[model samples]
Target: MRFDFEGKTALVTGAASGIGRAIALELGASGALVVISDLDAEACRSVVEEIAANGGNACVFAADVSDEDAMREAVEFAQRKGGDLHMAVNNAGIGGPSVPTGEYPAADWRRVIDINLNGVFYGMRWQIPALLRAGGGSIVNMSSILGSVGFAKAAPYVAAKHGLLGLTRTAAMEYAQQGVRVNAVGPAFINTPLLSANLSPETLEALAVMHPMGRIGTPEEVSGLTCFLLSNRASFITGSYHLVDGGYTAP
Candidate 1:
């Protein structure tokens, strides 16, 4: 599971928890100095501490991904700390209201699209230049099973995720010859706080049954693929969506 990122640097949004945290830790362990980013400074620092305790280099930069200026600053901040930006994982996002499409709040929809879709764009807008400055790099945009399939009561999230594929593909095509690689990672229901806190046991069980694997995936599992995509091991891979979805979309 280890890849050589020695002397390289990476910026990971939503690194304070869940799949993002796992990717940050793995990237650090693989020898890359990590920039841990999230909305909460304290939580970001906690992840930094964990990386440091494990003999990995990391720093915290708190920023709301929905803000374009903040995201740009975050990329700049990481470059200042690490001397270059070789990788970026745009993993920050939010789950909008659980109500059905008819009842879904307009404000909530905008908030979700802003964070999940616009946030990725903002992250890449700055990250691409940073990578170019470093001569080349990689990016992994976090998508979801909902990106490829319909999910009840999750109109905004679904739309935003689907949008990511288009963005990822176009960015890949535009930057492929320029040495930057762009791709998306779609995970099924993960055993993260986001899902556990929002769903009842009955609902969770129902979701598990929807997957061919009959179980939810762990954050580490998704992180493994993410790190691989960021590594030179996947140098020929870009503009594609890799599913860590327990075969949820196979049907």
Candidate 2:
């Protein structure tokens, strides 16, 4: 699907790899000037180069999503480079240690919540104003199927994701009247470098079968929905959570 994002500027966090990378590339290809924000400078630059090679315009802004100052700087960078900020995708997240909540380490839980939940808040804390300043815009917060349901031995991740939905909804309601739409995209078991690095092939195959589609989704699949929510095509959408999970949460 193609979107006409001409004259629009977008800021995408954690855009150097995985699902974030896919969204950034798609936005750029669709004619938006993209700001690739990620902690890895090298990886962010690579994404920028890839977008440029594909006849798209993009720039890299390396920053830790958990840092409010850095996230603010990222938004400023996007506005300075691409003009008004019309779009944003808060996709930076991390899967915490697989341990029962009772035994989950305080440090690990804090880290997970900080990155997966608080980071998104920071992004929007700065992003919403920019969009409002631009007159109108959209924001897609990357959630997970876990946002709707619980998973054993994954309390921190699940909690953070669940919290994200509340944040998305509140932001949507507050800004919808102002022409800034806010929504969440929940993807399940996407095939990304992070997933592959953490799970063995045998485990991955097990997870694939858990989904009704009998396969884990691809980052591009998640990106398709994400880009749509960011586009004018979803102009009527806001304060809702869309699942691209192959029916993982359907049952």
Candidate 3:
């Protein structure tokens, strides 16, 4: 299971905090030249500085993943900094307001769908050609356990995640023979700020108990799985979905 990404360049979106931040740090630590993109410009810069201080090559770019123009600019920034972009983690997304699907606010639904679905689409549509020119690469879409199943109060979020999985599968099939591997990571409950703020403590405990492991997972745990999927070590694992969900879906 030893995999190295030395000499490779990786672009990670939504990297200012939470899962995206964890992924970026892990990728940088694993020897990939990293370009961190986030809507929060300051946060992005901080991540780059931290990586640099830690002896990793990194640069930061700010962009709203939902904006096509922003996504393009972010890619260019990565290319300029890393020289060759070889991997992408389309992790930009949001959790829509919690409510019954029927009562979900239209604006919130649109916002979530835009960032979670359209954002990834934009990232891939633009990155694919560059990745091809760079001689192929791996892509990891950050879906959720909701991608595989429905959650009662999370209509828009569930829809977006499910869409992400479909997009990953379709893109992987389309590019497999061409040497690109596309995959999705569906984590159930990880200790990201998203969960801490958006989800209540009781809900978190309930989610933990739902897992056979009797606890939620961690960001580093998910990072281990993501790093594998984004490396040559997973050459034959395209069009796949991984569950790093503390056994939540196993039962």
lDDT for each of the candidates? 0.95, 0.95, 0.88
Worst 10 residues of 1 by lDDT: 94-103
RMSD after CA superposition, every candidate: 0.9, 0.6, 1.3
TM-score of 3: 0.96
Query: What does candidate 1 score on TM?
Result: 0.98
Tens digit per residue, CA lDDT, model 3, 71-172: 888888778877767999998888766799778899999999999999999999988877887889999999999999998999989999999999999999
Which runs of model 1 end up more than 4 angstroms from their true locations? none
Model 2 lDDT per residue over 1-251, tens place:
89999899999998999999999999999999999988999999999999999999999899998999999999999989977999999999999889998999999999999999999999999999999999999999999999999999999899999999999999999988999999999999999999999899999999999999999999999999999999989999999999999999988
The superposed Cα distance between candidate 2 and the true structure at residue 197, in angstroms, equals 1.4
Q: Which pairs, if any, clash in model 2?
A: none
Tell me the tens digit of each residue's lDDT in model 1 across 1-251. Answer: 57999999999999999999999999999999999999988988989899999999999899999999999999999999999999999999998778899999999999999999999999999999999999999999999988899989999999999999999999999999999999999999899988898899999999899899999999999999999999999999999999999989998
> TM-score for each prediction?
0.98, 0.99, 0.96
Worst 10 residues of 3 by lDDT: 76-85
